[model samples]
Target: MAGTTEPYDVITMGRTGVDIYPLQTGVSLADVETFGKFLGGSATNVAVAAARLGRRTAVISRTGRDPFGDYVHKALREFGVDDRWVTPVERYPTPVTFCEIFPPDDFPLYFYRRPKAPDLVIQPEELDLDAIRAARVFWITGTGLCEEPSRSATLAALEARAKSGTTVFDLDWRPLFWGGEGGASGAGGATGATAMATARPYYEAALAHTTVAVGNLDEAEVATGLRDPHACARALLDMGVELAVIKQGPRGVLAVHRDGRTAEVPPTPVEVVNGLGAGDAFGGALCHGLLAGRPLEDVMRHANAAGALVAGRLACSSAMPTADELEKFLASR
Candidate 1:
């Protein structure tokens, strides 16, 4: 499947799966309704977003030999993500997230993740280091670091990319994946803060190889233990990253460079629909902008616009704007 003379602009390495939802508006846990399924995962979302934005993108992940796996592969292809490095396994079942979104407030969404999901079995041998080395940027997430073979596999990919001088972009923190204990599942019904505490080592390992680090206000606070966005961004920069971007949601984004420069790019105005996948859109667009050698301010603006577009739409992947759409939005601003 590795038939290409051209190198990809970005290669995403992390989890891939389907999102099974039983969702409705203004409902509670007791007032559930109909359910729908969608193809989703952080790395997959970023890869699709980058591809749709006219960048050469590839996704390296493992999926089960099940119907959900088939759906994920087909969905990635439909979104123009290059799947040459995807490995389909026969043993483990593809990961499926059974989510119930409590309506009206959009905050109390509950998730049921199956144990030993296919994506969790991503071993080092499953990845093609040559393909990883050929990429300009390697996009990764913190959720994938919650498990064993997948964690080592991601680290190996990053190491290969680092040796080849490829820029590593890390989304520093994800509390849900840490579970209860310090491992995959949580220990003793720990709170979100405790789960986040368990994610520190993974974050530190990722930060060691990252050139660009991106996180929202809450994620930033968790990773660096700093509430101030600027201070958090600065702290991340001090950790050897050349660039740090703190996403402030409706407040926009704050970007800081190692050279002592900073900028705050405001988000574009749009109607809010679903906020899912917006961070991936922003991260993907920011990677695209960096690969294109766009100025820092321009990168933030592009990411902000891309994020706003994702927030304004219903479907996760369907909401990602095209390059032309992003350009138009930027020009108007």
Candidate 2:
């Protein structure tokens, strides 16, 4: 556990679990014989990614009281992320995600979080208010707002932080987690607007306490009811964020600052292995660049490059580039 006197570089809240990925690419889960287990979850991966980049990071979440939960802790420690705040929930077994890797485009995820996920049971009273507020960067995700005590806890942390240092709201829109049209399958069953309508208000509430808002076009629309990159950024700014980052998959990222400065960087080319972890990589790098007070354009470019590096790899948390690796990758590009 880190001492209270020294603030961590990054503190991320929400979601922690194990990911069971098929080692064989392009094979269905039904036929896959071997698998690899790693620490998984959006917020958890973000913390690990930051830690990999030499940031002093911790994750505030919960896991089940099972072997899988033990792996979660071991993984966090190995990744250099403080696991002090990640407790165990006795009621639910740890969540596990199965992914079918298809290489370039399609990697379908199957979430086994039925009944309830331990992370979603986070209580507001369990939060360390001072730690959240004191961190250089506090990262929270949209999924944190999808359920009960966690939703209130997430908001409570955001409110306590009060935009201190750098508060990031990652619009991690997982419809399956929301009990919406997507259910458990990879296929889409409804329009984005339908899910957006249910989640926009909560997203807006979180944005009120965030300094930076990041998401793709689909998530942006879910947060602001806007699809246009410029309009979405404008809406996020109006909601109290100082910066808005719109990640347009193929087109790269668009970052808009309230000071009227804007940077639209093109995507770094890579032969993508699993794309799911790219966003988390981008997020960790974004926090790194922002804490260093880099210019908006440089930050976006650095984040883009970091994301590209992860996309070229298979694992999410383990593939996060170290500071040396990131610099080399950027230089080579």
Candidate 3:
């Protein structure tokens, strides 16, 4: 969204890793014969998505001194994402995620993060404040707030938005990473109540600093303890979000804007393939529209089309469509 003079249009800072998926669907990870690997992590996906949409994008994160890290770099460059800020550390190993595919993506992920991933070590000192402040749009996710230094660093990056830029919070919440009384390892597992209480303060603080908050119904519920879309939007808006959106898969996305305006884009039909990448696609396209300063209705519809294009695709990052592709898809509907 930044003009040609700016170094980047969109910038993202957060966790990134390798995603390994079993090639065969309807099979368990234990039984899968072959697998495919790709660049992943929510923020990384959003970067790739926006880049594919023709925005100059950059990602700020670290990977381990391993082949997986190499793969991540190559994948980002191949997708036109600037990885100049992507670091590689010697002792730590890059995180790897593996999942068994069920039809339409009923995939449960197994994250290999026992020793702590390098991304969790992104200290505040390492950030490029100039790059963060210069971008037209900056995005971060809840997972980045799950740990310490990364959490501090993520908050610091948000500071740039205050100066000039749009800050987007993708509530990429993973209960498994929140580790404690309401964390993944809890005896009976973290309940919705515990999860809500544990996640609220963190979400609230970040939401206070962010301008745009994007999440699905469950994510909104976890962050605000509200299931009703309207209440959820109000709570987020109360936290100072200029715009709050709830992405309802089959129904549509409900959006509440600052000027007492709201917009909804009903689901666009597509042959469902794997549902893993739609949200990321939505984030990318949404950045495009917002950066263009397009109206809320146009923005919502454009974002819906972007996600719909990926819903029926085979992979994640590569599934994101270009601007021309998105417009064509929308024209069809």
Candidate 4:
């Protein structure tokens, strides 16, 4: 706990691990000769991205009591993201994720979170309700909803937040994590009608407490059972969020506010590299924009630009642009 009494700019809960990415571009994992290790997990990356843009951020999750866990703490401190709340689970080892960098579009990831991930071991009792409620932005993810203790803990945080400030629900939607039969195809693969059915009730519960919702089209479908962007936005708004952001790959992003305001921004063009952490970058920028009280259109544009920068890079956390980099990229466009 870096002793700071002031409210945090961002507090994200869920997911943390080491990302092992192939350094060689456009190569299969089997043929990859070298790899780069970096701190990862959607929530962790978003926290790092926000920290990169000069926001005071912290993440609430758990890690194993091992070297990887130590690495997690070291990395968070290095990135200026608070790790006071990141505790350790004696049972599970820290999760490790590997990916094959297939450029222009395909990036296949293999998750090594067997028995259970320490992140999913985050129990409600361990949460600091005061910190969560006081943050300027509180972010949670769908991946946290796939399992127990974490699912309950996530909801507890949201409930404590009570729609205060910028409460965001990131519909992460990892099918494999949820045990979906379709693998990574059906909502990241936790699929089949049974998986979707199991997830919706929890999504509904989370949305009831969140003010902002963000996800790609596939994630939106998992949350609302709707594929059309407009409908997905409507369903999210109806579910109780004040804002709904739909990320459409290639085409761009659409943001709809309950106050009858809407912004549709096109994707910023960039040669894709890994394309894995773009959404996390966008999420961090979105939190920054919201905290700054920018117009919805400007927020969407800024987020799109941030994401494009990371999509063109190799690593996720390290690839997040600084405030200067984001401005330069936006000005160049």
Query: Per-residue alpha-carbon lDDT of model 3 for 96-205, expressed as tens digits?
Result: 88876676647677888656778887888888777787788989899888777788998888875573678899998787777642124452235545655666788888
Candidate with maximal lDDT: 4
The reply for model 3, stretches above 4 Å from the true place, is 1-5, 180-184, 187-192
Winner on lDDT between 2 and 3 is 2
Residue 283 in candidate 1 has what lDDT? 76
Error of 3 at 21 (Å): 1.5
Clashes of 3: 0
Better of 1 and 4 by lDDT: 4
Error of 2 at 307 (Å): 0.8
Report the lDDT tens digits of candidate 1 across residue range 1-333: 354667788888877888765556445546666766777777888888888888989888888888888888888888889877777878777776554443212634344445565666788876777777777888877776777788898888777777354465556465666773223445522456876676767777777777888888777776687889989988888777888889886688899998877889887887666667677888788888888888899889988889888876655666788999988877876
Residue 316 CA displacement from its true place in model 2, Å: 0.4
TM-score of candidate 1 to 2 decimals: 0.89
> Candidate 2 residues 1-333, lDDT tens each?
234878999999988999898889999999999998888999999999888888999999999999999999999999999999999989898999999999898999888886788999899988889899899999999989877888899999999999999999999998656653213322332444455566778998999999999999989988887789999999999999999999998998999999999999999999988887899999999999998889999999999999999999888988999999999998998
In angstroms, give how far residue 97 of model 4 lies from its true place: 0.2
lDDT of 4 by residue, 1-333 (tens): 333479999999999999999889878888999888999999999999999999999999999999999999999999999999999999899999999888888998898887789999898987888888889999999999988888899998999889999999999987677763212334435334666677889999999999999999988998899999999999999999999999998989999999999999999999998799999999999999999999999999999999999999999999999989999999999
TM-score per candidate, in order?
0.89, 0.96, 0.93, 0.96
Scored against the true structure, residue 178 in model 3 reaches a CA lDDT of 73
Total clashing residue pairs per candidate? 6, 0, 0, 6
